[model samples]
Target chain A: MIELTINNIKVKAEEGMTILEAAKTVGISVPTLCHLKDLNPTGACRICVVEVEGFKNLIPSCAYPVSEGMVVDTNSNRVRRSRKTIVELLVENHPQDCLICVRNKNCELQDLSERYSVREHRFAGESKNHAIDISSASLERDPAKCILCGRCVRICNEVQKVGAIDFVNRGFSSIVTTPYNKGLNVSDCILCGQCIIVCPTAALREKSSLKIVTNTLASKTKYAVVQIAPAVRASLGEEYNMPAGTDVTGKLVSGLRRLGFKKVFDTNFAADLTIMEEATELIHRVQKNENLPLFTSCCPGWVKYAEGKHPEILDNISTCKSPHEMEGAVLKSYYARKMGLKPEDIFVVSIMPCTVKKYESARSELSKDSIPDVDAVITTRELVRLFNMAGVDFTDLPDDEFDNPLGESTGAAAIFGTSGGVMEAALRSAVFLITGKNSDNIEYTEIRGNRDIKESTLKIGDLELNVAVVNGIGNVETMIKKINSGEKKYHFIEVMACPGGCINGGGQPIHQKTENVIKRVKALYEIDRLATSRRSHENEAVKTIYKEYFEEPGSHLAHEILHTEYFDRSR
Target chain B: MNTNVLEKFPQNDRSALIPLLQEIQENYGYLPEEVLQQAADHVGMPLCTVYGVATFYNQFRLIPLGENVIRVCRGTACHVKSSANILFALETALNIKAGQTTRDKLFSLEVVSCIGACSIAPVISVNDEYFGRLAVKDIDKIVKKYSARKVSVSTANENQES
Candidate 1:
């Protein structure tokens, strides 16, 4: 430990900690742009500069390692000037189109500019002239607004292990681009949108389908139905000033009702359906001696990554669409048929905590009868915007339940929001299906946690089942390499693209503190523990759907509606 | 088109084009068009896109016959110390531009964004070897060492053939 004095306040901080970190430890606020917790400190932006008693010039507190007996002035005139100058320089190149930007009020750069009181940019020069590239199905890139903080590059390279982007040119011409400036759709990018989440400015954004959603809602011809994902309930409350991990499922259901939708449903219902079909497929694969190591296909980002980088494992990936898409398909087809409404009249919208879900909805193969499964997709952040725009008092709204049979879900479905939840959910059903007996023990403690890579083996009746769960794309790369080297042995695998699965998804609530992620994940498990139907098979709604509609699990009719295929994408 | 020449190398497995391109550049002087074309066929990529990528990065080249490659540093310290001017002088003396090899098969000139040897500003490297504290006159002496070696190799080959 080291002792330091910041702004005349004596503080004790850990050794090897940066000044910004030490200041934070002492409750001294330090603004930063490119410094993300648990990621490398690039110190590219000079927003966190501070004055040292012995140093000649102001130093960036984010990158400067603290020393013993260091005296720092965090709010001195010199420090303030350095921060202001950095903000002014950033504003000079930034676009003046803030009112229309997707991240208008939520933008970090705009918030910092207001806090620093940057009234005018003295250095008026020509900004970098680059066209906005919306070539990818999920993401948009506006290089003109990029401040070159390298957050996207770092996230893509360090976190995802997909080095599709890098610093290309030098100095003034320096730009972040894929190799040969190929569009992201044509590049090796998996469309995870982790880059979009970390970007402090409007340089990266999800491709909005808001206009299509609004059009559907406006038309009297179509009946707009919406479904909210499990992760969305745990995160939507954060935008309404609620604490992290607050379960707002009731409020979210009521809020969607206020949004003029004909029905408000839950993706968890379809998540239960996914478990039924996926577990049955695993048992069939084990029985038929075909496509062993059945990989979970619920995460679109992981599905895309597996398709592009490890195409040889296509046969191993399960043939099921994600719960969001599955619910869309089911709503437009099954629900539409049951209600005596045309499939075209039912505008299926999914409120997902994922940007890749947007891309998944647009896949050509997802269409059942020349109509896209989901009419439009919106993020939880966008849903909050819609609620506020409609003058809905989200905080004061009464708790309401999701509508009808389609809205019902199990506790196993709720846990799908967090990491290892899918594997645990699948195991619960797999053991029952394999042994033809309900095991008293449901929780697979070996496969449940926030670990990057987790693997376990168990004896289910006469068969030995091995399973592996990978959370983070970078960890998936390591696991893939081990599998390719013939060192990994597993009968089933679950991979989520984000670091902690859909609970901490890229489209989830954005919090600066790292602890908030853990808090949100904890809240999901708590929701799972408090529920009566702890297993997917135990959910009466799921049993009713199968007995009334599909007849049996893994039936040909069920496969046609629930399953999809993957293609190899080489770069 | 010569199978024997192609078979002489094992690392030239067409499946590994990008890495093989880097390796061939490291071993040979530069990536000739023929070598790049062979790599394009191996990787099943169009020759145009391969050439486009080779030209996109400052790291690649398409010429041949350079005994020693010279890379003048252009890091922050070196830039402040006018190392760019040193590079200009080397480009003029060798009569070959940056990322290009001389027609006489003597030297290849290149410029790097950084060498990471900041304390010794105005640095350059010859054939993967570092040379610091460079001056305008140093270009002449550096060129002579490689030219002399090239002359001996050609003469030795001719004598053995005769």
Candidate 2:
């Protein structure tokens, strides 16, 4: 322990803790832009600079280590002046059109400027007029608005291990962008959008599909259908100032109706469908001993990562498309046929807690004859914005149930929002199908949590099933190596690109507290626990779809729509 | 993108990024995308990260340089003495934008952060020959002199030995 006097308050700080962390214990918060928690501090932004009693220069509290008997003045007049000056310089180089920006109310830089009372720029100079990269299906990168905080670079490169963007060039010309600034579409970007979440300003944002959705809904010729992902319902309420873990599923269904959408479908129905198809595929593979471990292809980010980086294991991945994609395909095909509407006339929009879904929806492989499965994908944040634009009060909205045929789902489908939720959901149904009896245990707590990688061997009936759950795409390489090297054996493997699965997805609301995200993860489990049907096979809608249309899971018709192929994009 | 340069480094080592990039830049004059990908493959680093390091230093270039690279300084001293006009004149004379190569690959104009010759305000160095106290009127003559002469591509350090 190190004794330090922070702002004249005598306090004891943990040894090796940064001055910023130490100061926080004493009710002092040093503002930081580039200092991401748990990641290595770049100290690129000097906003967190603090004055030491003896030192002449203000030290970056985020990077500087706490020393014994150190006297720190976090909010001294000199420190305030320096911090204010830094904000002024940043603003001088930054765009002043914050009123019209996407992150107008929820920006870290804007908050810092407000706290420091920075109204005018003192040293206005030449700002870089780099072109915005809108080529990416997922995100738009506006270099003009970037403050060069390197938060996006750190999160994408360090945390996600994608390294899609970085601090390119030097000094004034420094901008976070993909290789050679040749646009993100052609680059090795997985389009996971982890960078968009970490970005402090409106420099990075989702390529909005709200305009297309609104136009499609208003069109007389177009029969617009909307579907919401499992994770979205848990996180969407956060955008409306509601507490996290608050199940806005009822309100969300009601809000979509208010947005002039008559047909509102839950992606959870398709999640149950995914479980059926995936479990069947896994069983077939296990029985034949061909592709012993079936990798989950539910996350397009993970699928793209495998395609681009590990093409050798492409065959190991399940052919099933993600839940929303399956829903879109069903909406265009079966739903369209039932309603006597052409696939072209019906526009399917998916509300997802992911930006990668935007990329996935636009995939050529998922499309047949140039018509994509899902037409447009709007993020949870974008949905909140849509509701706001339509003058819909989310809080006062009456609870409404999802539309029938594609609305009803099982509790297992609801749990598909979390990290090991897919593996658990699949196992719950797989065990029942294999044994022809209900197992007392439904929850596979062994494979749960936000661990980078989790592995477990569970006794299901007579077979001991070895399964691995990769919570994030970044933690996949080690497990992939284990599988490839024959060092480890597994019957099933589930991977989601974003940490903690879609519940903490990149397209979710910008959370000021991580507890909110944790609450979202728990809310999914709570939804799973307090449901009538807890298994995928028990979902009446899924059973009906299988009986009426697709014959059964893994049938020819099911494979045609539910399954997709992978390509070697290893550039 | 040549294989000979990449095979020299040990594979899967992140520490070899800087030296490997430096060697690649030295061998190929500029860091090509294909070669950068290969280098990243060799070091087990992402191509974007390799690109970031390569671009962080002005010493490295993504695009190939022309026959003669004209560097116009934009240091504090140079900027104060109307270096923007000097750069503009060079761009007009070369018929290319700053930080761009001429259509014929004869000249590549670049505005350097600094030339370190602050005493000689607003300086433009062509290859090795330093032209201090540069004026906008002298830009055409300088461009013509370089274009007319037989092209010789060399750095300022190699031939500018006093």
DockQ of each: 0.06, 0.69
What are the per-residue Cα lDDT tens digits for candidate 2 across B1-162?
367777788899999888888899899888888888999889998887888888787677888899898999999999999999999888777788887888778899988889999998889899999998989998989988998754443344447873
lDDT of 1: 0.83
Q: Can you tell me which runs of candidate 1 are displaced by over 4 Å?
A: B1-162
Off by over 4 Å in 2: B69-89, B96-100, B109-139, B149-162
Per-residue lDDT over A1-571 for candidate 1, one digit per residue giving the tens place of the 0 to 100 score: 8998999999898888999999988799999988877777888888899999889988899999998899999999878888888889888988888998878887888988899898876999988998888898788889888888888888887788776677766677677777556687877677877888788887888887777887788899999999988888888878888898899998888888887899998899999999999999999998887887899999998988888778899999999988988888888777888899998888899998888888888899898878988878888777877887789999999999989788988889998988789989988888887777878887778777778898898788778888889988889868877777887567899999988888777776555666777878878888888988888888787798788788888898788888889998754
- Candidate number with greatest lDDT: 2
**How accurate locally, in lDDT, is each candidate?**
0.83, 0.88
* Steric overlap count per candidate: 0, 0
Clash pairs (backbone) in predicted model 1: none
The DockQ-derived docking category for candidate 2 is medium
- Indicate the residue-level lDDT of A337 in model 2: 88
TM-score of 1: 0.81
**Accuracy of chain B in candidate 2 (TM-score):** 0.81
Worst 10 residues of 2 chain A by lDDT: A508-517
